[model samples]
Target: MGLSPVLWQFLVHWLHASALFPAEASGIAPYVDALYFFLVAMTIFGTTFVAILLLVFSVRYRREKNPVATQIEGSTLLEATWTIIPLAIFLVTFVWGALLYFRIYDPPTNAMNIYIVGKQWMWKAEHPGGQHEINALHVPTGKPIQLTMISQDVFHSFSIPDFRIKREVIPGRYSTVWFEATQVGTYHLFCTQYCGTQHSGMIGEVTVMTPGDYKKWLEQSNSGQSLAQNGERLFASMGCNSCHNGTAAARGPSLAGVYGSKLTLTDGRQILVDDAYLRNAILNPSEHVTAGFAPIMPTYQGQISEDGLIDLVEFIKNMQSNYRVQQTLVTATSGEAAPTTPSEGTTETVKP
Candidate 1:
């Protein structure tokens, strides 16, 4: 085949398999692109104007030829004019940009929440229903999806070029980004931050599908098989059950009912036991010790790895709702091992 024929065939294949523009993927893309263009135009205009003025003045007022030129005093009016003009321009840009920004930040009330954990060289995603994907994110077209992101290791960025949305996933904190995909296709996911040696290798894909197709995918993804489930298995494999068992007076507090509860510190300070806290407690046990609990928990710091933390957190959160079920079993079947109640006289104490 001729070169033109091969090129045409390639173009045809891409067109049939891909959705290119904002209209094809999501309605929000065009607005984001427009804002980007506006900023670019303003920067270009300002730079060009300054460059031209410098060139013109240099040639017209050459030092040798204009040695006797009149030295005019600065005018307050000219200074005021320049300052006011630039201020007005900035105000206008600020207002426009703010409007667009709020729109992006304010997610739809009905949007589904997906948890994203960014690690060294991969993106780990999980839906509320326990559907998990590695290095790939799937969302339903025409429905807004909010991603709650956090870094498992170092800082990383979750960016979708087609949606023109990106957010930094910082360690020890949660960051969120949301977008509604208008079309159904695969879009690129990149880590814009230079995380480590494998930063460039951190890439993924966002697959958008129709509502019906999304439901089907969700069902398949959650068919009793997922990373979240595997994480539970891994937790068991690591002997985490020994300390976290509900019925035992184990070294550490029971993992049951620990998530989303207010944990009182030794100094009478209260901290919410959210996902981030749970993860940190696992990776860096020395960071925050429970009020009455001894600092005997081993630091899984580098040994457990990033993926291990995600699995551990998922396992802990999953046990939250089912904790009561296990509590009853513990009391009835394992009365001797199970504590009848929480530690008595467990008043908060300050660390010296």
Candidate 2:
């Protein structure tokens, strides 16, 4: 049967233009939805056109009306018209998709950075101010938020359908996704990948607040130490300063101003130091050993948490010749984090 008005309505309704329409919370959502609708419209048009031609040919070539079958010559012009039109349409679609992809993946230089770690059955979010949340992420509206995520266990997908953003969080690697919230409301966050038995329960909420409210929340939710501070503490506690001290006696490469610097590996490969490179160097040191140093740095594969690794990365990125490690009581015991109180004990400072 030919596609009727009822079929057209069904196609449109099934795509969730009504109750199931996703909220356009981020700046990229409207454009994403527009592209999706254009694709759906094209699909519907192609189906309708094919159905009409089928019905037309069936009625016109009926045996009762023409007794004998006749062969028709193929028209080069008709063939060329169909081929070139579909080719042009496909090229346009590809260009549109590629542009949107770049827009979604490239974060602005000043975007707010937030670190996310996913493990079996739960998600942990850490802010630069040291604020930590188990299942909820709070961000300010009208500001670009960039999330650097990693999976502590199996692979997981961090998804926020309202923002039209999703990225796969892989173990031993970092994944980044950014979005600028345009609305002040709460949206759903989910792990779209199945990890274990409790995968379904690995869900959370993302709260988008006004800039002022977000500032107030940040002030109130202070974790007593900034991420950089924690990184500084961890830096000394882990004895990282012994090798990365930037001194003549140091055995390993100095990390001062090395975050974005180009360095050559022992194997004659050159690489630019970035977040991923830092992470890999920390967890898998032998892979990117510096040209003049031995690969004696032990891998911190299971010794450090993802959040702590992020802290170390931040510290290294901002490290200068004058930077020093701020040793607190927490550095005394690397096994656990000591309580931060009104009376912060004596701190020891060591230069890089």
Candidate 3:
């Protein structure tokens, strides 16, 4: 009991994190600290052992001690021992690190989802309940929260020191990171990458609260609808329903039950329907042309905002798990039937 405080002080000092970053407030923090401490201890021991050997050899084998030089011969046993021991230690380190890497990257199925978009100098986080926060995220303790992140402009890294987790948000692609807060407190959020002129100011805070408090916080900020609900409205406004109405004669393939499923592309390559693939198919329909469909859809690169795109993706992902499309669409916002135009009926298709 008496040594507890001293050990705690030593650990805090050795990590060099306790002063700046908060105490371990995440499930993975302790594990990360353990691995880091182990490596540091090994390094210190190796350095001290080598220094001691050098000093002892210099004094014991000095010129005056023997007055005669003797030929030194290599010992195979000693050489083998040194080589094998280091190799074993390295292998152990590798395996331990690999397991931890997977555990950190691969989120559990029960984890909650949060979408984050990184721009030039700020972070945008969106919750399922339609709560939006800029540069600040609120989450509950004890529940796993998975962050699906992407960059809107230059590359940015989302780092939280207290959580011992960081992930790069790159443009044109998605990156994911997850953590479970073990304590309720505020932690620092930083963009480790130097993004732009205001990179230093690109900082935020993660407010972790008790489960009850988190629920209340969300309720207070909830926008009265879900992301998927908003996406459904946006999808209608975009005139996608005119082609992807999920009918027999509909030009586009049915999106129901298509997410996470495999489908072949027009280029004879099979690909899984994921968030990245869906986003690309929507923005660059011609490039990701469907197998049977003609490549006639125009690009929507500038038409839809990033937030709109995210909502649409969520809608498609949650649409018809057991197969459901509440209503069929015939007209876009223009209220004109697109399929009736027999000539040059080329349009966007979200096939498979």
Q: 1 or 3: which has the higher TM-score?
A: 3
* Residue-level lDDT tens digits of model 2 in 119-199: 998889988888989989999999999999999889999999999999999998999999999999999999999888999
Candidate 1 vs candidate 2, lDDT winner: 2
* Candidate 1 TM-score to native: 0.66
Which residue pairs show collisions in model 1?
25-182, 25-183, 26-182, 266-349
Candidate 3: residue 195 Cα off by (Å): 1.0
Q: List candidate 1 segments past 4 Å from native.
A: 1-24, 44-71, 91-135, 148-157, 168-176, 191-203, 226-228, 246-251, 254-257, 303-305, 322-352
What lDDT does each candidate get? Answer: 0.75, 0.84, 0.83
Alpha carbon lDDT at 132, candidate 2:
88
| TM-score quality measure for candidate 3 | 0.86
TM-scores of all candidate predictions against the true structure: 0.66, 0.86, 0.86
**TM-score ranking of the models:** 3, 2, 1
Task: Please give the ranking of all candidate structures by lDDT, highest first, separated by commas.
Answer: 2, 3, 1
Instruction: Kindly indicate the candidate among 2 and 3 with the higher lDDT.
Output: 2
Angstrom error at residue 256, model 2: 2.1
**Total backbone collisions for each predicted model:** 4, 0, 0
